[model samples]
Target: PSRSATLAALDVRKRRDFTVHDLDHRHHLWHEGDDARRWAREAAKRATVVLGNIEEVEMATGTRNPVAGAAALLDLGAKIAIVKRGGEGVYARTASEEVTVRPVEIPVLNGLGAGDAFGGALCHGLLAGWPLRRTLEAANAAGAIVASRLACADAMPTLAEIETVLARKVSA
Candidate 1:
């Protein structure tokens, strides 16, 4: 579905508290020029949180820098913006603060579902009331774990698996 249509269909008043938009790279093929930016800005405005890769954000905002793109989303009324930079890290920005979670190093076998894994882990952290940094850490680890496995959905890490990855990071 078109981003605008998706936005139009959303009942922000009833679902804003839990709504999150993952402006994933796949959407790039569906939009162009100002339309993409407009849709992105509108999506941000309607959702409680917005998640996108750096490239997606840049494309959506017509900006070269992801941070600038995130700022634009915030200016458009997004409560939170998360820009995922593969290998480098994930950067999360709120009205009050910004946090960067470094990527976990792992051999990548498949990346198709890494973002989905990260988003799921992020939701888990948020629902559990974990701090932003910790949430990002777990999300990043989840992505790394998925990327390192040959299968996508089958590779999604369990809580114990995520903890193991975090523990390895700390010990290193």
Candidate 2:
């Protein structure tokens, strides 16, 4: 954007550690000096993982198609790309694999903390060496629990809670 970068600390570097990028479109900034459409794609070059909502992914990759957007991110060097589809679940893609995890049905109470919970659970799953689909499934469950609750920190789900949802789904 034409407006100066607000967060100068944001830099995607070539690092040995795995990096996850949750796209946060800075729509408030002017785009005269920058191209907002390619921000996520550009950042993907240095990211190991990229995750965003459909709108955000479309804005970043210039495509509303989730599969194409994931491919676009992968083309830009991201190892994994995940498009959050809210209640429809998430579309996760890697060079060799792709998955669309089913959503956990729940009564919507407060959705404010869902994304945060999802991100935290994503990191937890990745760090724990879970496969992409398993990671997304647990992340989705964590988000579902948060959305079904009213509190903030207290609403954040535990690993047991997330696994319980997964276990139930499996048993069903």
Candidate 3:
């Protein structure tokens, strides 16, 4: 779906269900896609958060430099911009802070939707009003858990399970 149209929909639906107000974009840039920037800007006006696939950003923008892109989003007023870096971790930024959360080391089985899982967990944490550090930690643990197991959505750990990993210092 087009970003601008998506943003318009979110604006209407936000009051009813904030959980469904996720901002997703295909990881590509249109160079001509000024609409995306405008959408991001508009969502920022409503204090919306942005989550995205890193590969799409790299392929479309011709760069994987999430920091730069995040800066653009921040400038446009996004409350937070999360860029999933797969095995490395997640890069997140807000108007006041920037954070690079490293993934916990774990044996990998299959890598699919790990980034989305991490982003989803982070969104959950935000919804719960967790602090940024705790949110990143929870998100990282969730991604690591998903990476270590073979199943798709089934690999994602429960909050209790993630907390267990967070408490340990396991070497991957």
Q: Candidate 3 — what's its lDDT?
A: 0.67
Model 2 has an lDDT value of: 0.82
Superposed by TM-score, candidate 1 places the C-alpha of residue 108 at a distance from the truth, in angstroms, of: 0.5
The full ranking of all candidates by lDDT, starting with the best, is: 1, 2, 3
Q: Per-residue lDDT for 94 in model 3? A: 77
After the best TM-score superposition of candidate 3, give how far the Cα of residue 62 lies from its true spot, in angstroms: 5.9
The TM-score of candidate 3 is: 0.72
The number of the candidate with the highest TM-score is: 1
Candidate 2 residues lying further than 4 Å off, grouped into runs, are 1-13, 26-34
Descending-TM-score candidate ranking: 1, 2, 3
For candidate 2, the 10 contiguous residues with the lowest summed lDDT are: 1-10
Listed in order, each prediction's TM-score against the native is 0.89, 0.86, 0.72
Model 1 per-residue lDDT at 162? 97
**Candidate 3 lDDT for residue 5:** 76
Tens-place lDDT per residue, model 2, 100-170, is: 99888888899988988999999999999988888999999999999999997888988999999889888
